[model samples]
Target: MPGDSRAATNAATVLRTVLEHGPVARGGIAGLCGLSPAAVSRQTTALLRGGLLRELPGPADGVGRPRIPLDLHTGAVGGPVAAGLHIGVPSSTFSLVDLRGRLLARRAFPHEGRPPAGLSGEIAVGLGRFLAEFDSGRPLLGVGAALGGWIRPDEGTVVHHPVLRWRHKPLGAELSAVLGLPVRVDNHARAVARAEILFGRPEARGSLVHLFIGNVVDAAFGIEGTVHQGPGSAAGDVAHLPVPGSAAPCACGRTGCLQATASDTALGAEAVRRGIVPDPSVPLLVDAAATGDPRADRLLRERARAVGRAAALLLDVFNPALMVVTELSSVLDEGYLEEIRTAATALSHVCDDPRRIVIPHAGPAVLPEAAATVLLSRVFRDPCRSDERARSHPSV
Candidate 1:
């Protein structure tokens, strides 16, 4: 490997080791990451100076200062924080998270009839106000924006967002220009997959598939801790994937497509049509189900089954170590998640263990944490570059 690349790898290894085993000594990081003591020392010094790591009080057992524990700088005052923006059809969620991907604060900006032409600017204004209210004098790293559709993260562009009517828009640069901070953008499905690998279960790093069910339904695949972004970074489009036993008509004139059958938009519209909710809103439907509405419950179960059948197809193809389903009802209620797992296990020929299909580790906060991980993931991959970016953009 080249000198710079080797150094970056070593730095990431040390940083991740500390993230997994916090309040640990440098010797422990070296042992865990298989790095030499000198390399660990070098990276730790850089990390500490860059405000990524902080030294904790050493043991009272009379151990020398060399045993001083180190951990991610998650202090309430001066620790670094990344802003998260998740743009959905109905609303956009803004969040602030620590280095460990823990959400600190979050606010929802409902579009509510806002025109899509300049919605990005409106979201940026709302996000700026949210940050101002929750600033806490911390070192703001930047913003990580995640949304649906074909997003080109390399160029920070939204290749296409059907619901939002965005086409080849430079979302990152636009958000950065308005917010006065660096912004990184990616498909929300891939953002959730990367978040799972970085902060969720250990099995996710080995291999995982994340299925996002929302206004848009999509899937992301990861292997060996790397999320795959195929040609044009348009890998996770499961909108048109056929779902078993679903006869819902899609906009493309196709019947039984996954998004048409299982997405929140479809489910909400169906709920409204069935008189289960007043409007096309999944949250209202879920609330009705929680309030002992049998009609709502049955509708949700039906959608869950469709999602499970679609998951089965992905499982049969990838057979990943884990399948993470991000759905509102499932994340909030275990009974719904069980319905999905049972249906998926029954349909998947390769996966008999229902335990393999689960909700995101962040549960209800999945989108918020996943959106922030869009930037935190980059920081973990190359701390040197992250530090450089932070130094270059100090006003955030």
Candidate 2:
């Protein structure tokens, strides 16, 4: 691993490799990372000096003879401390966590209005309160803001958040400055996909796709261990896809869009029209379904059919090894998962094993998992190493 400018960044990767899949042997790390023994030793020394990692409290992970192993000191200042925020249509979740993808503290803030500045202020107050009350004296790392709609990751800008009426806002810079922490912002489903990839299950590290059917119905695909963030970061917006027979007008003014037929808005509105639920909150409708309400059951079944169809299309395009879905009601009530399974199975082309589909409940750890994935990107492709290595290459 030779390059242009980021010797330190490459060094960080060496440490992360050991910290992540390490305590492994130095030769193993050098072999996997393509660095010589001397290079690995140099990086390891720098990391130990920085106090980011230390020898494991036990015997080494030696290739032949016993050797001393290395591991990340969880209590290290710069060790973990990443945060993630998921802003939904009506509610937003703010979380603080560590590198191990554990949730230290999290609080959900329900949206009351559409003023960005005021809402930001209130959210800031909430985080400050959390910091004063529970944030350990350890150094704070960066925060990741996860929201719906088209988000430009490199620029840290939100091109459009239809639900929040946020257009061309520097959400990343603004929130980072306000909260006094580094920021990483991206599409909500992508952030959730990050969580699924890193902390959900070991198998998820491979090619996978995550479909989040909630306030925002979006899908993200991870191929060869990397989430495909297409040009302009629009790899997963299938809501505008004109699936036949849906019959509802979407924000794009398209007919039969999936969102019109499959979103919470569609289901809740349909249930309300039939006088089953009073509003467009799908969770409440799901509550009714779980209570044996015939009308709610009917609505859920109909919605599941449409959602499964959308998932089928996604599977055809990505052909991922697994699908991790986060559905609102199904998480709260395990039985509702049967309905989701009915829909997915009715449409999926995944081989005979349904275990390939994992529906996990949303928990506090979801946020940190999202933030860590963003940081984890740099761990895999050290920008610092790439820069320096660029110089090592013969010029064209």
**Candidate that scores best on TM-score:** 1
Determine which window of 10 residues in candidate 2 has minimal summed lDDT: 382-391
Structural similarity to truth (TM-score) of each candidate? 0.97, 0.83
What's the lDDT for all of these models?
Answer: 0.93, 0.67
lDDT of 1 by residue, 208-245 (tens): 99999999998999999999999999898999999999
Off by over 4 Å in 2: 1-35, 60-66, 76-79, 113-117, 243-245, 348-352, 360-368, 375-396
**Which run of 10 residues does model 1 get worst, by summed lDDT?**
387-396
**Once model 1 is optimally superposed onto the true structure by TM-score, how far is the C-alpha of residue 319 displaced, in angstroms?**
0.7
Cα lDDT tens digits, model 2, 336-394, are: 55666666666666534556666742442554356445644443344233312433663
